[model samples]
Target chain A: MAAETKLFGKLKTAEQEHEDPKEQLMFDPRPREELNRMVMEMMTTTTKKFWLWAIGLGVGVVVLLFGAWGYMISTGMWVTGLRRPIFWGVFIVTFVFWIGISHAGTFVSAILRVFKAEFRRPFTRAAELMTTFGLAAGALYPLIHLGRVWVFYFMIPYPNARWLWVNFRSPLVWDLLAITTYLLSSTIYLYLPLVPDLAMARDRTTGIRHSAYKILALGWRGTEAEWFRLRKAIQIFAFAIIPVMFSVHTIVAWDFAVSQVAGWHSTIFGPYFIIGAILSGVSAVVTILYILRSTLKHMDYFLRPEHFDALGKLILVFSMAWAYFFFNDYLLGWYGGEAAVRQILTLHATGPAAWVWYLMLICNMAVPWLTLWNRKIRRTPWLMFIITLTINVGMFAERYTIVPLTLGHQRTPFDWGVYTPQPVEISIVLGTFCLFTFLYLITSRLIPMVPVWEVQEGQVAHTLRKIGKAEVPTVTELD
Target chain B: MAEVSIAEKWGLVVDQDRCTGCNACVVACSMENNVPFTGEDNVAFGRGTYWIYNKRMWEGEYPRVAPAFQPVMCQQCGSAPCEPVCPTFAAVHSEEEQINLQVYIRCIGTRYCANNCPYHARQFNFQDPDIPEPMNSYLNPDVTVRSKGVMEKCTFCVQRIVGGRQTASAEDRPLRDGEVTPACVAACPSGALVFGDLSDPNSRVSQMAQNERQYKLMDELGTKPKVTYLKGGGRNGG
Candidate 1:
């Protein structure tokens, strides 16, 4: 009966939709060809400014990565402000911060996908993009931190003419292995779902985009078998990658936690770091979505206030969880009456780097706690934008306190010294940002940022049935 | 068919009271194992790829937990949890030798083993190891330097075990335990750490294992690690 009515309704498709826009993002019919065309337009439409910015960033990256690093290698660690107390400085902090940012991508894409969150359909690719690029940027800090980048291979258990042994007993070696596993697995995870979208792009384009998509798409035709295999592969990866994601950050946390550093040593750090990563990372996603909507053409059609609102709910939840962990860590340390930990706490409040401490509290705790409570504020794109930016800065400050500032104050008062990075360190950080942007900007053009099939799948599963007085958006599980 | 004894329980005993936190162990471990010296920036950000860490703790204003430096590594456990959960067997435990080993070539860097591990003792190769040319020359020839995508952890010096085994065979003597020790244990000037076959009742490590202060890290999780710690010289001097 419904099928017959829907067939009859085809004659008045527009009229029926106007009468009941119950199928908002998904079922509101669109020519698959037109949607495909929009993706093509976004890719091929890069303007003069894009090229200029690209070139400028390109130039900046090479110089910063090569030039500054070259100087650090030649001069040694002294040029940087690192000393006895503040040994671990900005490099390590940036590493954690970037890794934290990377967490949002997998969490949003995988967990939400598992739960069938409809809002995740449009922005999953955008979030996934953050994972690959963010990891790439985060991975650089370890190399840069090596005062001598050239000899880093020693971490590899390789034997040469020397009869010496590569001791597998080092956590550094464990780290070397674990990160490699994560980066490759994540890249593969990011690529699996992207194949069909690439095929879609491949079919629409003519020049370079066509070739790029053709290679990436791997001749995907979305046949039942192909889709079946892709889905299976995705399922395996989703279940597999979640643990890997948790481990990657946890291992990263262990890089500090397993040791006895005042701030670094904590049994709770494994979950704590993972949670912190997700919180900051989700905020980053909000910021990215806001930028994409404001800057990219036709993004508003795809990204709506509803999406922002849904994400805001997540941010609010994550904020509360992060505070819980933060307080847990503080309460235990404060109660234990550990002198080094107290010094860290007092220094955090009234030390030389006190500004960073307050900024961290305000952005991470107060701002998110107070501002995100309002539904209108949470859903409002510009407001979310400002808040997300503030949160990132705040998270960075938090990491700074945990690392260098905490390092600055130890049991020995005489050995304490403040850490300051050289110009090289600062420039390289700029370079990493540029590299991330460069990669994201490049990716924006090639792959369809929006997963159309997912949206279509969502549409097929969704219906607006009248519930009492108002029509509520309803979804069904396609899988 | 011959019955095979896999390995005697491999363990490291850290005498915390003796550790000076002089960083000699850190440097020695890096030099012996090709650990890179990541700068303070990386270390501060928790990006340091250090496999061996020297740590200190201070508690309150007047009564601080005075500095206690400890060199912590993978506790190659009798019931190694990291081994069972690895999807690819990238990280495996040789029950024969009681070694928690990382196979870099096979490792896809899933890091699941790392997360399941309660000790937080594992590390991932976030980036390719940065070995300078001259320094690369200094790397041990026996072990295979790993690539970018793998999970790695302390193996209790497996290569050295292989070498020691070969030497023992060449001399036609049964392999005596304690012939090989990890760089961290070997480099300790204070002789605080003792490595040997825990299964063997007569070895020094075996005798030390029965001490009253013997405790495994995160013992509540039941990792059953070979490594034990004699905290603060066992106060009673056991």
Candidate 2:
């Protein structure tokens, strides 16, 4: 028994050399009231700087996204760089990027919850917010890219005077159904855990804020039955939404896969796109976490280096997975022996837009592989932020290469063309980015950015016990 | 009544050897179909609304170079890739005429159909038709002048086919095989283009479709294109 205890002591000291268990959010517990107050303060606190940024983003959305979209719609598709062959361009690329970003929320919240990862307590709400707003930003592109935005509803299946139904066989219809289902489900998933926090805010605030929280909280008294039902509802949605999230990106992939486009027609696209979505989505979560930590009040307590370290590990895994798919896609196309596919693959590497392809590789594959594996780098907030931001840029390049670049080259050499995005497309793309940030900014103030109740629950379940000569942190299954 | 029992199953045959690359067929089809001529910049930008355009291919290097022009229009494939992908059923196969049709009013312009078309035959109306005052009078009365934000393509001179059928029905006689030629075939100076009912095995298009040199573009794709091209090899034996 003495020898066994000594062996355990040595192992514990080795583990302690890397990280003090007390630095982890779960082990570093604060009083319930203090935690709640901190979150409420973050929500209520407003500065001139915040207003300036919000107003700036709002102006960007108005002019770049909506104004440009309206001008393009009224003037015609000619205003955009979309021409023959390159029918889908920057609009579609950014659309896919937003959808990919949205996947982060459901993945971090639902998947991590289902897996019972203790590190996911504080930042799940932040990630889930991305899913909702990312979708809002993404869902707009399908309409904005349309030739006639007025008749956009024609794609929706309804009993119309024309007595015609949308073609169910088309992948676009599937995309409409899938994205709608995902958005509704993910919003509900984000709200379920938020209810208890809202109830907490309701008890403390007055006037309009109190009334708003009261309604949003659904009159939660935090009774035993209410807690049980809330947990059960979240549990159900947690499992149910995983498939919905996967389906959303998979269907998005089918939009390209089901086409006869040379490089796009592949069976592997469904899983490849889903993996790509998760990579971008999870990287986005890290980016958002870094922003929140730096800007928001008292965020350093909830979002720690441990959380960044954990997310960095996830991003690294996803980056490797993305690389695997990228190579798999490339090799298969090269080996497929289809002349058009071969030509397209060559064009991607050596063509005018080869820089985009190289950027995709360097950012998506090389950066994460080189930097994220280091424990210090993973824990470094600003460095992880830069890496995650780079990954998203890489992801945007991936989508650009898949949509417009592939479309530009095909079987017929005479019809081959290159696409240069016009100013209108660039403005609209920037606008969606602003719209996402603006929505997030408004939502951050309106609701508890951190789920206070969840953090407290995790703290209650986590305990450090003395084992041999060292204290070891352990988590109890609260659910 | 007996003549109307069988669908026409219209087909076109292009004799590439006879085509002089003069673009007369392109001009005639544009005029007959009322296709808007986008300005020079727009045309250079690949926004030209030509229902038919000759794809010019350059063979060999500098001194040995020769340009071969292949006039490509909508093939009206029997099983078109564009039809199934269209969200609004804007691209539909006409059972009566046994050809593919684009319903202008139904198109929401997703451009998925254009992307799927192997021939790249479809054209989008990027801007409103800019026919100068006097030129507008020459626009065909039978065809609809498409506005911006809609997809248009060669309809196989569908209006002419309908008119020919009406005339034959009024006369109480079967429509002649050569009676309903598309504007392209009618205007071909070298008689390079032939249009007829392929449902009749003895039709001129059916006879030409069996020639040894006849081949469809990208036929291996199994789109089952209705248009056939006789190989052009008079100069280079290609």
Candidate 3:
């Protein structure tokens, strides 16, 4: 009996040196039903704690968003502290701010998908969810910035007694068109991949959830033709959506770029905004992934270290790219030696909100540079979460600096005024957060937030082979 | 309706040297074409609707840089980028009249056309505008109300062209070259914006386009636009 025990103990010691295949999700396949159940449980298992947070956020959003907005509409824009020189104020800052956040999903899903990045498969849905809801939230700031939300229709090109036709000549108009296209196409792009998961949910769910999934699933079945049609559609959209995504942010930048306004006029603003959007957006995804992997049960197997490692690498690259663009923009303006440009530059770094400008650098450039480079830190879900949160704060500060902060320093000092967003503006922005998280949570239960079929598909394409006495992972060209 | 040859292209030439910045054209374009008045907040953001935006650039410093007003509009380029990129045949360059036409009835608002437009001229209806009580009656019936999710841009006031054509045809005479005037052209008190047929050698626009001072905005982009501007002739920059 002692001999047998020693043999078993010896076996355990050796096995400890190697990872257990059963814990490796790819090596240990669960019954499809079991994985579905876990996802379902996470959805339905909301605690009193959840309700408390939701209600608290909801009340906060209501008071801040709707109430303050109502006040802004009734009283003029003067209520928000916006004046001539600092005309753009917090509203435009928030507009550009949310716009940067909107870039993550497309970069994660489309750009990564185009390159066949494997780790993207599981959390692409989570990222895509950010694209749709994030865009929705981002689009609202322009209208909210409008102050008179009711007469918002006047922006449309509709004909009637009012002789106003939409002037296509303005960048503001382009901002409208580009964002609308992006919001819709991204929504469609997001939904196209989600159909199968919706079908899976449709099969497992009952009552309202079943029908909700059914309608959204578009009567999908996993037949070869269904897959074929779906794949073709996705491929088309995947290629098509990238340019639209790039254009949307570019046009948003053009809202400033294509102007005689000093500091606004630059050829690089198009690519600059595009890169900025992707950088901040990916950081948001990183934060979300970290939260999900840590807070949710059974998410560890789906969200592994390898995924975080891949994301960390991307974050690092994007951080460098952002710094390059930031320096390029700064160098050109500084080199030009234009007096107006100098004033704007001075205001950005030395003004009352100068800390935000500096924090923009430390957070966007410094923090990511400092920590995300380490694989250990990148792979730590909790640490990465804090980093991503900090990145977002830094990015928001960047937008704040660009819009109101820069606006604070204009040609005429007499017209200068500091910007402060109204409580309504604050609330609505909060509501958007509540709305995004609420949608994500609800979707988690209804649809497998992780696209199981895609994961399975990847597994099918991947195999371990004996190459030179080593089990080297190889991928097949099933696609 | 059909692609007109570049040789027969229509365009406008504005003499900025003569412009007084009267803003009459701004109000006129809004009046004739149903352009919406931007609310107080949008004004602060510098996002008011204007088919023709007046740009003022300062040259020197606090005491020296003088603000010079330059009126700008869609340069309806011959190689129109906004035309071919549209997935649906919604935004098309007008071949018959050489004007870019925005078909509100057909546009799906995919906005691909807008992005490709180098001139940065295209607007989308983010929300349906609500005219105040009884203010709805003031809306022009000629223009279509843009539903949500569709692109819109200046058509060089196409409805006016149609109206002008109809009136001319009814008058029992070939349409006079100067008879059909766009709002900006008509309202220019200093005659800064001169609108006429570039196809006719005798017209003022054709002559203006030939001037040494005439230039196009972002000429390097190769839009081959119809709108032309006489070079800045004043102390605003110099």
> What range of 10 consecutive residues in model 1 chain A has the weakest lDDT sum?
A1-10
Q: Output the TM-score of candidate 3.
A: 0.66
Residue-level lDDT of model 3, residues B1-238, one tens digit each, is 1222344346777777776666787788767666666576666653355666666665557876655667766777787767654433467777767888777655544444543554545654433454687866777788776654456667777777667667766775555677778878888887778777788898878887898888886666567888988865555222
Q: Taking the candidates in order, what DockQ does each have?
A: 0.04, 0.83, 0.04
Q: Which candidate is the best by TM-score?
A: 2
Q: Between candidates 2 and 3, which one is better according to DockQ?
A: 2
User: Candidate 2: misplaced stretches above 4 Å?
Assistant: A1-18, A464-473, B1-3, B60-62, B232-238
Could you tell me every candidate's TM-score relative to the true structure? 0.66, 0.96, 0.66
lDDT string for model 2 (A219-247, tens) is 99999999999999999999999999999
At residue A116, give the lDDT of candidate 1. Answer: 69
TM-score for chain B of each model, two decimals:
0.89, 0.95, 0.86
- In candidate 2, how many Å is residue A323 off? 0.8
Deviation (Å) of B43 in candidate 1: 21
How does candidate 1 fare on TM-score? 0.66
Model 3's CAPRI class is incorrect
- Cα lDDT of model 1 by residue, B99-137, tens digit: 788876555443445544545456655445777778778
The parts of candidate 3 lying over 4 Å away from their true place are: A1-28, A159-163, A465-472, B1-238
